[model samples]
Target: MSRPMEKTEILHPSLQEVHQSVDTTRPGSLWKKIFAFFGPAYLVSVGYMDPGNWATDLAGGSQYGYTLLWVLLMSNLMAVLLQTLSARLGIVRGRDLAQANREMYPSALNFILYLLAEVAIAACDLAEVLGMAIGLQLLFQIPLLTGVLITALDTLLILFLQRWKIRRLELFIISLISIIGISLFIELWMARPHPIEIASGFIPHLPDEAALYIAVGIIGATVMPHNLYLHSALVQTRKIHRDEAGIRRALKLNFLDSFIALNLAFLVNAALLVLAAAVFFHSGHTEVAEIQDAYHLLEPLLGNHLAPILFGIALIASGQSSTITGTMAGQIVMEGYLQLRINPMLRRFITRMLAIIPAVILISIAGEHAVGQLLILSQVILSMQLSFAIIPLIYFVSDRQTMGKFALSTPIKMLAWLVAIVLIYLNVRMVVEQISGYIIQSDSIIGKISAIAGGAGFMILLLITWLYPIRRKSLVQKGYHLHKPQTPTPVMPIHPYHKIALALDFSEKDHAILAHAFAQGNPNTEYLLIHVVESVSARILGKQSFDQESQQDQQQLAAYVRMFEEKNLKAKGVLAYHRRGKEIARIVNEEQADLLIMGGHGHRGMKDLIYGETVNYVRHHVHIPVLIV
Candidate 1:
């Protein structure tokens, strides 16, 4: 007898394989369990310590001399709390933040949220690309534009690593993070910052307007909008039991993972600030606002030749590590909100290109100063989008209908709201201050008009985002339904078919296709099950035939046929050894299928553009009506 499929078995197709690769059933020590849940938080932690954070932290430390350290600490605390909520949303509800938003909100609202999220991602990527280029310039004496082009090639590296193992990718990121930590620790030792002053820096203080501007930048850089979405999706990587105890265990382990990783990130950020304060500020280089400026000063100020080299190395590591995670976050966001999946390679290229073009253009026109200003502007843009993500996250996690028993406790809920309110206020104030400053400084009448119009337009958008109804009135009014379990229903085809052809990939999505196909099946219909085994590798290796591969595919197809036969349905299986896309098209033609039904991963953006989807190829190749389940 076949085991019944659990709801938890359904996952985003791209992540399904890596989801829960750890052994949940094995009786293991606490350390083993901790190890299993360790990867996601570290991936997210990279964003916190990325090159974007560096610009803000360096600026804060050099200009304010550790007075803004409290902002970093506060931001890290906010990250810890929000990330815990994000992980719980994924583990308990089986939905990433984007998916949850899609399910909960109307299309119009979701579209607005999607656009804001994209802007945040682009801003992040801009900082990363700019930082990497600067690092390359500092280290190899390469031209900035040339280095920007070189950074785009990292997309190929990202694609290669993704095809490897998820664990390998995680370890690679962790290793880079370790390099960053060690590099900064050595710098901290060399700088010899006062322990008492460092401790006092932890106490919150805003000395003036300039301090406030840097503090907001620090907050924006620290609690990233994309990381919230990325963490929610990444936690779903670990496959855990969907039962009560399983969720509780996963949540505990996930929170611990977030806590440890975020603290490490906090330390790295603090170290950057402390090093800047001790070495740069004390030496009267308080105006060192740019990474390039910092690099040029590090060697002379510290009197060690290695100081500048280490800084360059750490900057490159930060940019590259952050780039990889930013790409993944882009994939997750597109798939979850838009139900669109694309080739990971193309997705990386598209996002990287978007960031590269403007950066290169600005750098070429304005030169080096533009890079620092752009990096800071990117963080500010991220801060503006931060509330859009946070508000939805808090809303979904607090709803009893959404989180069930895992709904936030009363005090926690209050705390989350307080955080949300504070972030919203900070973002608004930052925008107001920027426009007001522009108005005061502008000598032209046109400049004042532009500032007034931009400020007004931005405020209107924020008002709409806040007032837009995300939940249905009845759902909101009904409040928490602690006892009821909400199960999403699958939409099935309404029209009956005389003949149907189904494509199988033997992936986790195979069962979902089967369920949808069976839902549309009847006694009168003839069902054809087709599985194709590609011999590209065999051909590459100079082998004529893949007998073992063909045999395995045949067996799997037969099992599927048997499963259908036991249900008393007229079904037959076909195993073909050929290329995936071409062979599937041929079968659809030869079998004379009236309606072709198959599973689709629904890739979007550059992935869809660069590497065309098989479903798309098949649709164009054949004349039969097709339905992608």
Candidate 2:
């Protein structure tokens, strides 16, 4: 079995920090069970109602009145269905959309998809940066540019939140969601919109060419591509049982979570549009398109200062909440597509910078009024990228081999494709309309050439993505690379381990654990000893802890390393912080250990309730064989 240890290098999971990080196995009531699975969707839900959304809904309501309310409704329905499919993909396949796309699509196609996803994220961050800056301007009267600078500091906040439990972060987002919902409710109540008109707004109708532009923005803002990618990875944070029955149960509960969470987002969005319709459109302030304009007019129209104050508070909350999830989605996409790993702080900082630089440039040149148009343009870019992500998702979930019995039924497959086609059609039509209008108005040869070239390039890329999967099947059938079929490689016999890791607790049994670890290793073999400091100081301060217990643990580990060196065998000692079993797994992977040997306390039954079973966790998290002595 040791012979195969070198072959057992498991690929690191998507969102490695939080993959199966939540414990839903706690014996509890039905309600308690429901709460356990409630987090991921709440996290994804915030993205659906982020600052980008506020811009579109505000523009729609102020300009088109409640006519675009149906757009929001339609977009919400689309969002709910697509998000449910994303969750189902994650729970059933254990692969996020990016991961699935990489595995299923060709390499060149994967790179393009990755780029498109990044563009979507950057566009989203643009809206978020502007939204938050606008919020600060409205609330505390900060200069817009200064507030934009201030938004960059949230990278630090993301790094801070990441150090805590996943559920804690989810709760933080939920609190923000509540603030936004309450603020919207108050705005709706104070405006006292005619109930009949609000109802009529739900009936679908686009009033003009301008209305069509805002309608696309609303749809783009609502059913985001990044959110779809984000949702799949977030659902994997839950510890779902892997059997058919267990997976089905997880799917059912997560669907409930998505339904409730997304509907709340819908209400926030609907209220934004409604508030604008009632307060601005009817009041003859129809050009109140920008958030700042709406903020200023809120007090005069609603007859209260509190209306704008609540608006600002909600806007800040939305921007802050959306950015956190946006960074996480960035991580998922980068790791899933390119297999690149970087520090979480660095990743967040880089992503924020991408968004910040664009906003800074645009604001410096055109001043503040142009921010609203930029926000809407960002959503349209996101809308254009939707099919690349969606088509792959449909291909994966519909495949019988990938999803097994849980694969979507034929009718559902058609519906999913229809959604994808509609998104693609809207995106193409909008881009063509913009280009055609631009070419007609501009005499600049370079500008027209650039516009047409860009449009054609994107269309070509989309066509390739749509056809690549089918083309792959056809290539193999045509025996394009036909040589005779190769025979399968035969398995070799097991050999003794060449490299071993010992998980030591510094208890007296550590020596016994060492004896077991050395048994399978030859004189040429190397050894690594791993221990985690779970003391209060070590837990709180991590590697910087200089407390007595940490010092002693460090010294003890050094002593163990010296003892092994005396035997003339290669060896080293490593200190890990926080959780014991988790650290042990990380160390084992880092050291490239062929096997892990750890001593069990044999604390079964009630004793297990006190100290926990770490050995099981280590084995499950690591690919190497674990020998519990």
Candidate 3:
């Protein structure tokens, strides 16, 4: 007889595809929806107060004073424009900006944009590390390097927090925002200036050459690149139902959300600039690099107690709040572009090390001045990176295929293109300035040619990046399955009251399986960890006599118990039971374990009889959840 028609089993769709299929709805409570909308922007706000921003704000205030306040407004306006587009793209398209860029561009163009993005993120990370170091310097008098090393421990701590619910993370962020707001507000109030002069500062006016750099600094601090990426990703976290009504409400609420949060960000940034302008601008201090200068200057005017505490709080909040956002941004980039799945701790470590290593090496060799230069350089790099992302954002939003009925109006598209062109031109000019001054003598003809060429090449590259997605059909297909509908899964909640017992045979495979399960499982539920101490392998099985074996078994059990306790696992006990005598199912039955998870492979002999020595035996006997890894 012909072999029963052999057919390949249909493969299950990936978990990600399934997740995307789920429908989202606007929250019933307007307040809750408003709160959720503000969630992602906080990450963006960190860029405004990071150590790099501190450096620029101090430099600008001390040099140009209130005259440069207009730049802060311009840049914040720029940020609102770009970030709003990013948010709209996310809600309407069901994709973050980075992922959108990747799908739309060619392989070569996508890779370049990806490389720049990685560098931009790394720059943000460096600023975060330095900010943390500054915080340590203020709080504990620790050296920057030591403080940098201590940051590694924070990754593990952050990972631990991931076990908690998402709402808890939101609460933590809100608390940080409150701290940052209070600290900055007090500092601004301390630096009281003439109301007329402050008002004129907000009005547009060009200052001297010395003030130009400060104006640039204020602009740099406001229009940060990572904030754009962050806002896009954050808007996607909402559960907005796909219908027109839900989508429209999400748009309205999100715009309101951006308007409120970004306005506050503007106020905080303005406070930093004002404090600097009022205190240092009038004092003939044109170049202040360290955050300490802000405090020292204030000491004679605002008294010792308020000044020191204010700067210290600002520094601490700047570092801590930015670190959380930087870490999350790394997660989004890796997952978005590479489609790589990584735990939060591992991703944080990788991103932190990359950002810190270069910073430490450069700081050690070049000192604080070099670190300050790196901060400015990071912003320049951000401007260059922004052009690549912005062009695509404008194009995609205008495209009927992606935006559907929500495609941009002609005026909006025109405005977006105008913004893109201006950003490209400004970025190009900055690159030319850097090349002429740093790469060659500013007066040399060769330097001028190189600078012009550099600017031209950069603009060309950006144009290519924008055109790439429109040209590559194959990549578009492979990179994103845009029309795939998300499937809904029944929410199955494991009761916290239900006790679970897990049995492992001391194999690496079993340990790996348990780790995966734990990462995917709810932490609220209680679980018992058990390591069976049977004489299974030759290396460990026959090495000891009966008394020695029992002692070894006891020791092993104790160690495992301690390990679980340290990891915050709800391990009940580690019992030394021989598989030779006790049935695995029978033991689970006695212990009243609602679920049984064990190694898939088992050895023959009394092991099979007592332990249901193999998975088959246990399956036959246990009427419980048996997960064989």
Candidate 4:
């Protein structure tokens, strides 16, 4: 077959607007280039220390008094390993976890995995919403109901932030992470725990089943499923050369990136558990599972008002930073699995609403105190979905046919399997314990049926994914993977363009665009010159628009057609009045053009926000080849 379109380009790309958008190939000092790979992991790091993590950390520390610090260390190590593998997949295969799954797994299985992924994102988003709302309440004395409602506005923040560069978004997340780290440091400084006890806590001792549960929680909260999907896609933001040497360099640098960012996340989490151990567990008040209670207890117990204020600030930062990343992860999985794209603002709104509606109902019916349990429940829900993401990721990166020279070696693959087994066991154990508790103690038959049915379905899914066979030999022959055995690209039949679409504006640059279109075909080609009238009247009135600007646009188009006729070329002029990008896409489809030629406005940064990036919009919506001059 003629070389099929690159898998990423087959349908669409992951985070297409920012895909390979950041430049890492520029000549620079090694450290400068290393720093370019740093931001994606930092964004992934926030998920490790999100609000979901706080509940577990605080609970682990306050109840066990730093005894589970080893668990925190263990979980962070797992996070680093899995995240590195994720980045490896993206860097080498140019496919996120979701997209890779789409190609490798059957469609029915893929759909189920997609639903599981969405549920995971929604659960994570719930924690963020609750965390931010609670932080606002603790710091500003805003009522919890009002604070929860206020959290909805962060979707608007997402809309505003999506307009800027990916690096800008990363910088914003890093700033928030710094705030959280500093706040934790200040809290730790004020509550001085015994150094020996803190050191002894890393001995891997678990006092009881309660300690085990908390340990598993720390792991679940740390090794998030959504972050795996996010990291795989986010690493693609940096443009890296695809040669072996460059691939090795990128793998090395991304490991460093994961090490630094995840360890920072570990520090933030360790501080949370340790802070609770010192201020609450050691002080004999061990019931500080609730964040608000922890905030209240901090000021009195630590004898400083700034402690609570800083705590609240850190909480807000954590929620805000994580909510942003969560939204991006939602986008990745949706686009990667479903193979469709939606407005960022709309996705944000939908994800946020899924969280908010439940939070509001719980608070209204049971009171704000119930939110603490809800946070824990969300993490438990996430735990159920974690294995599905992790198991497939390990399998993908482990396949020699799938990953080629970058495939995980036997030793590393075994180790990755080890980590997978550990996490899967811990998550399953915790899920069983939680579900069993409800089954035995609760009276609701609906809850019982839901628990049993969901567990059975999850187990069935686990078996299906794990046992799903891969036809490695067939895959290699088909050249479906980046690393399969090489064959010469088949020189297939060539088809010249009979009709070409040229997207233009009545600017001096139009000449350059027209030149490129002519280069594609001679006078035999039927040229369709298309321009979108974007005036106020045109935007509101469509074809009926009779404003002066629209009339002038018509005249300009007619003149272009006349010029083409004078040049002994067949040409037709099409004028559309509406959303420029969609209108152009519609006319291109209607005209059955095989090739599309347009000019890049070279709009970057804030200029893109005002003038809009119609090029990206149109490219995604159209099926034709786009040649941007």
The best candidate by TM-score is 4
> What does the lDDT read for residue 335 in candidate 2?
85
Kindly indicate the candidate among 1 and 2 with the higher lDDT. 2
Candidate 1 ranges with C-alpha deviation above 4 Å: 1-14, 439-454, 469-629
Off by over 4 Å in 3: 1-36, 441-457, 469-596, 599-629
lDDT of 2 at 173: 91
Candidate 4 C-alpha RMSD relative to the actual structure: 6.1
Off by over 4 Å in 4: 1-12, 470-629
Of candidate 4, the 10-residue stretch with the lowest lDDT total is 474-483
Ranking by lDDT: 4, 2, 1, 3
TM-scores for every candidate against the unseen true structure: 0.76, 0.75, 0.74, 0.78
Worst 10 residues of 2 by lDDT: 1-10
Q: Over the stretch 1-629, how does candidate 2's per-residue lDDT look in tens digits?
A: 01101101224666878878886767889898878999899999998888888888888999988888888888888888899999988887777888777777767877989999999999889889999999998888898889999999887677578777898899999999999999889989999999999999999888898898888767777888998899999988888667677788889999999999999899999999999999999999988778888999999989998999999999999999999999999999998888787877788888889988888888899987778778877877887788788888887777765577888899999998888888778777777777788899999999999999998998899888888877564211111111234678899987778789998999988878988877788998889889999999988999998899899999999999999899999998899888898889988987789988999876654444478779878888999888988
Per candidate, the number of residue pairs that clash is 9, 0, 9, 0
Higher-scoring candidate on lDDT, 1 or 4: 4
Candidate 3's error at 458, in angstroms? Answer: 3.4
lDDT of 1 by residue, 1-629 (tens): 21222334344432554666655546789788679878899999999999999988899999989788889889899999999999987787666778777766767777878888988999999989988999999999999889988999898678667765677888999999999999999999999999998888889879998898888878877899999898887887787777778878989999999999999999999999999999888999999888889999998889999999999999999999999999889987887777777777888888998899998888889986788778877887888788888887887777776567778899999999898898889887877777798899989999999989977977786666666545354113221111234698999766778778899988888888888777777888888998877666443532245567766777899999898888888898877665667878998899888888888866744465365578878898999778888
Relative to the unseen true structure, what is the C-alpha lDDT of residue 31 in candidate 1, on a scale of 0 to 100? 83
Candidate number of the best lDDT: 4
Which of 1 and 3 is ahead in lDDT?
1
Output the worst ten-in-a-row residue range by lDDT, candidate 3: 1-10
Q: Across residues 320-404, which tens digit of lDDT does each residue of candidate 3 receive?
A: 7777777666666666666666756677888889877887787788775575666677667766676766777777667766566
